[model samples]
Target: MTNMDTLWLAPALVCYALSAVIFIAGRLTRTSRASGWAIYLLGAGVIFHALDLTARGFQAGNIPVGNFAQALSFFAWLTALASLLLIVRLQMAVIGAYSVGVVAATLGASAIMMKGGRIVLPASLQSVWLPIHVTLAILGFSMFVLASSVSLVYLAYESQLKAKRPLGPASERPPSLEKLDRINYSLLGWGFALLSLAIITGAIWADATWGHFWSWEPVESWSLTIWILYAALLEARLTVGWRGRRAAALTIVVFLVLVGSFVGVSLIDPGKHGGWFG
Candidate 1:
């Protein structure tokens, strides 16, 4: 990458690092102030990430959605942005640690992958559906990640309560169990909707470029698997009255599937989407 093209990485990494530190501090001290700082840092990181994506797009003379580094960077920014919005709307600063941790992991992986190779976009990827498909997918994935984080916290809190253990101030920082459940479902609803849109747009793009809507590419298969799992989770919640520990467990499982599709499948197969890892 050119110096100008890569300049955004410096600030992005710095902000992520700062956000991580603040998150850890907040977790350790059980203070909301540190979490607030983390939220601010995450916002700064998102801005830098946007600049980086914009620079790469200009350099490529098209949207930079074909490569792993760009996709991961975009995903990280979307997650951070979603987390920031949640914090602002729900006043739940306690989840900052988990959100920042996710961002750090994604960006760190992208940086390593970038050092290994350069991304080369294909002509087929240049289309109107590229942005639509990518944006929806990233947003859906971000919501799933957030839901997973909250589910984790819920399990931990529930365990502490069951064991009659003192969770200190940290336990008090998150919302109530009912509230957490509501938030998880809300995120699931939005995530599922976006994911459906992503799938449809991807199919349309496939048809436009390859004369077929479904080809069973490795990435496509994994994405469909994830979608099916989430769909099942939503159905269970609605039809079987799934909630509390059961719902949380199901969400955790679905989120694992989502991560597998996002990272593990890419690493293991690296099929047509291999250009993304470059």
Candidate 2:
């Protein structure tokens, strides 16, 4: 990366970290004001992050997902963007207490991984569909991240309620269970739509690049598997009227599988996307 890239990325990372700290503080003390301010800080971080990616894209003559570090960085940025959207739309800034920590940790890992040096986008992935497919997939995954985070909060909040325990004094209260469930359901619906589109575009890109729609490669197979799981979850919720604790628990479990499939499978399997991280 260039010096200009570092200049943009450094402040973005700092803002993300500071936002995480503030989010945590607000949640612990039940300070809505602190959570509210963290949103602006996170927004500033996203702007700086976008500038950094733009700089790298210009330098490399392509979007900056050519390397693992760049991919992780991009994923982190989108996750933060999704978090902002969820919090604002729901008017529940406390979600950031969990969500922003994930963003900060992801961005920090991306920064650490940046030492691998620059990589150019491969010719095979240079199609116009690259950004469309990648963005949709990452955005969908980001939504899952938010859903899973909210699920955790829901489970914890429900547990306290069930136990009839005092929740951090009278003035300090978490979001209602109904609100958390609503957020989870909304995220799942939107994420499923995006993931479905991503898979379709990916198949088109595959057919264009490799003369086949489905290679049954590890990456392709895992992507389909994750999509099926998400689809089933959503379907069950819609048909069986699944909600609250059961749905929240399953959402967390599904996301773990997703992370393993996307990150672990790509690193271990000697398939089309195995070398992506290297």
Candidate 3:
């Protein structure tokens, strides 16, 4: 990381953090311009983030996913890009609030993880298979993060309805349950399909490199577990006529398992895939 890189990245990180704050405040106050401003700030952050990451990648001769810090920074960048896609089409500014909050939080964590240090990529991480697999993993997880945020918002709104509480000005603006549910369902399909392919590609990589496709590594085991969990959720929802509260609850649960698999297990186990960084 060069001093010049830090000079540019610092503002981007600041913008992301500011965007998170603005999103939350906008949600709370029902401020109309807050959403637009949040978008603007997020856009700036994304631009700077891309530039900074691109510079780093050019310097390193790769996309910078060799270690936990680099992986997370790359993931956060993708999540922000994904959030922009989700936010532009939806009228739900509150969803933007929820989405940016997660992105910002993740970026913050990435900053902490990277903390003026660079990763030393191992042979495995430098392989073509690693970035392809990790990119898919990040995409899958980004959907999970967005889905979970939407789910959380849906549940909160659901609770308010059940409580018969007057819609506080702040809470009045969340999207309808039907809309939220539809987004959640769509995200599940996207996340699952991509993650399934990720598993296959990962296995291929494992076989090519490790001479075996399945190591039952802790991360691999958890990835399969999460895949099955989402698969079941999708099955029950589409075929079993599952909908509403139960499905929403399951969405939240799936995200928890996802977090455990992506971050928790990586921290504790840091298997062959993660051994280079942690």
Model 3 residue 170 CA deviation (Å) reads 13
Residue-pair clashes per candidate, as listed? Answer: 2, 0, 0
Off by over 4 Å in 2: 116-118, 166-173
| Model 3: residues with Cα > 4 Å off, grouped in runs | 115-120, 165-173, 275-278
lDDT tens digits, residues 155-255, model 3? 87788889997455664555788998999889888989889989999999989987999999888898898999999999999898787778888888988
Q: Could you give the C-alpha RMSD of every candidate to the true structure, in order shown?
A: 2.3, 1.8, 2.3
Whose lDDT is greatest here?
2
Residue 167, model 3: lDDT of 53
For model 3, the run of ten residues with the poorest summed lDDT: 115-124
By descending lDDT, how would the candidates be arranged? Answer: 2, 1, 3
* Candidate 1 stretches greater than 4 Å from native: 115-120, 165-173
| Candidate 2 per-residue C-alpha lDDT over 139-246 given as tens digits, one digit per residue, 9 for 90 to 100 | 898999999989988998899889998566556566789989998999988888999999999899889989998989887888899889988998899899889999
Tell me which of candidates 1 and 2 scores higher on lDDT: 2
lDDT of 2 at 104: 93
At residue 260, what lDDT does model 3 achieve? 64
For residue 164, what is the lDDT in candidate 2? 93
Best by TM-score, which number? 2
lDDT, candidate 1, equals 0.80
Model 3's alpha-carbon lDDT is: 0.80
